[model samples]
Target: MTGVPTGWRNVLPHLDYDLPDDLPPQSSLSGGVKVNLPLELLRQSRSRAGTVEIPGEVLDQYRRYRPTSLWHARDFGEAVGARVPIYVKYEGANISGSHKLNTALAQAYYYRRAGVQEVVTGTGAGQWGTAIAAACAVFGLRCTVFMVGDSLRRKPYRGTIMRLLGATVHSSPSGLTEVAAGAREGASGNSLALAIGEAVEYAATRDRTAFVIGSGETYSILHQTVIGTEAIEQLAARHAEVDAVIGCVGAGSNFGGIAMPFFADAAEGAGPAPLLLAAESSTTPKLTRGVYAYDRTDATGFGPREAMYTVGSEFAIPPAHAAGLRFHGTAKLLSAMRHRDQIAATAVGQVEAMDAARLFAVHENVVPAPESGHALAAAARVATSGVSDREAHHVARRGILVCLSGHGYLDLAAYEEHLTERLRDESPDDDLIKLATTALSAVPIEGGHLRVP
Candidate 1:
């Protein structure tokens, strides 16, 4: 794989901004108190070096499933009656059944080298937890995952898998930690923000334990570059070019991994930049309707503030079938790009996404995770709309590459709800959104565009 494009850091100066010298002094209540954001991690995340070398140990693990297949979805295209071809990189082929493993192993390796004895983390749909658990098993470290309670209940087998991998799992807000204790005073259901708070608290209180984030970090996103790097090479071998690259955006890991390399190509004037499209849940349409502002990454107000499109860290999101996409904020890099109109985004309702997933399953013979279904739904929209007319003159053939981030075998319960027409699209109340906006305004930050009223 050709490493990240040389000088890619120069493409987005805003994203590569200098780290805040006045970071809050380390404290248990503050974000990154016990586990500070390592300078090396930040540097690597924003480095322009063309090809950060993968460690031999990490490469050894990657050999088990490094080069995931990029398949031409001719059958799906035919089913959708698309005039152009469609391609998909199936990330579910791995043992963990998702792309989460790509970054998990890298993070586990780093923590192991740092002499961390245990890693605490949060998971939305259990994929990240399962991946980390497997990585920890490989590295001989202990793992504790605070899983979203609703998801844990819905996908019980995922927790079982984590246990089998020797990771301890708990339901978020389970009265096990101080953060969860506080969270339970007001709310009870699982949310990404709540789980993060618990995980951070767990890490902060322990020695030789570090908090590992699943997404919304530079390091994690960089590790995910493997996806895009591999896809670019696979596409080159077939002498094909994509007109658009689409992926579902929960925390933007998979999407960023697959799209950043192409973004680098665009930066270098190598070729026209493929249209970058992010599909988000209408239930928590952070990209579509949230404000672009400096906000905390977790519900408990821990961690360095980042500039991103957000629905407020404290905003109570309604439960949706696609639990993974229920995050309150987009990744900072993706947020910056969207703010500058460098990429496009759309929100899809749960029913619409489920319908698209069913159609795809009929043709492709794979049930997509609810989160991945968003991208499939978006791709179907593009194919049927004949949106290629705008760029038809510039390119002879129109093509789309959608990242099927994971399989839905473990999410059959969600499908059952959808099939029974019992699934409901639950959006946060307007009043709650207003409350969140007001709370966010209290934070003193400069250079943020607060679009929310």
Candidate 2:
């Protein structure tokens, strides 16, 4: 094995599991159906004692899904005044058109092997739901998705796709309490709903279902390492080097996937460690602008409370155009990366992100999601700054990689709204930030359940 990077050794310490021998071969059942064993055993294994196995078929499917091509945006590089090369790993090309599928597939396979009857999750841009739905269909498992009300209304295609995949989808804030009722009444103004919070609550309350967030669970990040694993191969094939890696920070799954592998390489001194940059919505700047605090995923009704960054500890949030970014805080892995200064966080407003999307379509021929556009905007800002080319170059240096988390096909209406100037630009107000920080500043009482507003 290649030498592990120094930073990774320090960060991850001793490896939790060893790498396995050749992947297990796929098995065929009675009806000529192909079955994966290694992936199942590895995912379902509770021993955590050694390297696990994944069926060769699953690994083959993984290869087909990964090592997604990297693109050199010459025009974008020129537009951004960057003389160096800039490369982006366009993950939107995935089967579900988002990075969520990478984790969803693994989670589904693992859960199915573990005898999980169902999987529950929350989605923002609907990418996560679509991914989970597809995985569930592949594994013949049931999936229930809770979507923010605003997203369900604004992006019906997402819901339709989920249904088509045979998953049940629900809009939060529709019932269950007065808070939900009031929130539903106010939902038409913005598509964001109380679904994610409700989904988490539901999952936590259930015994047969496992709740998966777009971002959460460190194991999820481990699954995403496949992206980095593939990226290393792809970049090397191109005889190129990455100076940095950038991706939007909604739930941070995509960001973590690509960054962690490189981090592993850096830990072992395999090569130069690329800087990790995470872009978030200015309107929902959980890491860059928000403080470290305990905040519920949704505040419309009493819901499962998870520690996250918050804009308002008590105030329920209105929906924003970047539906995927309406969350209140950062994931533990992301928080750890930030606290260690291994990753830098930046905030981009809706307008700027939309503009970046437009530029991407025009110059790159791919329409990026608003969340991805946020990263594009950050890349643009960093590239265009008057900093020395080398300095700036290193920031988003040519060969820099960006995770195209998802496509905007389902979000065409959002594109239209943006084109028509119907989408408003917003950033967190100082008072709101201060209020949220104040509310989260006090440490939560351990083992005391949160009392959702």
Model 2 per-residue lDDT tens digits across residues 223-268: 6666666667677877888777878887677788778777767767
For every model shown, the clashing-pair count is 1, 23
**RMSD of each candidate?**
3.8, 9.0
Give me the runs in candidate 1 sitting further than 4 Å from their true place.
1-39, 184-187, 386-397, 429-431, 441-448
Candidate whose TM-score is highest: 1
Candidate 1 lDDT, 1-453, residue by residue in tens: 433222112233324444222233222463334655455566676666755777778888887886887888888889877767788988998767899998898888888887788999989988999999999999999999999999998999999999999999998876877667667444546589889878888888877898898777766777787888788888888888788888999889988888887887776677888888888998888887787766777766666677677887778787887888988998877877776667778888898889888888989888899999999888877766733321231221578888999999999998999889998877666667667766454223345337541
**lDDT, candidate 2, residue 365?**
83
Task: Give per-residue lDDT, candidate 1, residue 366.
Answer: 88
